[model samples]
Target: MTSADTWIAAAKARADKRAKEGKVNIGTYTGNVKADDVIFSEVVKPSGHKAYDDAVKTIRSVQQAGFVVPPSAAAAEFTKAWQDAGNRVLLGERKPADAMKQAQQQAQQAIDEATQ
Candidate 1:
């Protein structure tokens, strides 16, 4: 019999047996509706369950010079760093590069005053 037919037969058997015994709770006897519940072979396996060998190979390649990280977390870090720098500038913290340029302008102003 097919899976469903097998399940129907099992259910009927459970109900019949329960009725004979006058057992009102038939839920427990209805367990294992599938006739062929053995051998849990994976059809596609769970996603993200990477093999150990595959992980080792990927790690080794990441250490190589010619390795490519396509759309990786490195891109996210770079974007975050750029945003942090812009935020530091906005927070009025003394930015060294900007301070250096301002100092150079002030020195030039002093030099222009001295020359004039």
Candidate 2:
């Protein structure tokens, strides 16, 4: 379970070594090829694992819906602050508005630091 490019690179490297060893067949995970959908695509409609296939569909749907955001350096800081604030609110230790205001300042600070 890696990206297609990574999987292809690793497979090629292993294939080269196996070819040098005079092996004609790459061993299947299961004893039968029909059971290994990742290797033999004809055995399965898409990815062998249902979870992976579902994830692909979900990602595609999200992309189509324009719910994606570009990666940012301030994201980590904002995530930490937001999670802390959320937890405090859940525990009745802070008001939602106050917690959010503090989290916003922290995220702004992170952005300022990155820009400097």
Question: TM-score for every candidate vs. truth?
Answer: 0.22, 0.41
Model 1 RMSD in angstroms: 25.0
Every model: Cα RMSD to truth: 25.0, 10.7
Question: Model 2: per-residue lDDT, tens digit, 18-52?
Answer: 66785432422332223333433432234355775
Assess each prediction's global lDDT (C-alpha) against the native.
0.44, 0.59
Best by lDDT: 2
Once fitted onto the true fold, the runs of candidate 1 whose alpha carbons sit more than 4 angstroms away are: 28-116
Query: Which pairs of residues collide in candidate 1?
Result: none
lDDT of 1 at 25: 21
Model 1: how far residue 89 lies from native, Å: 38
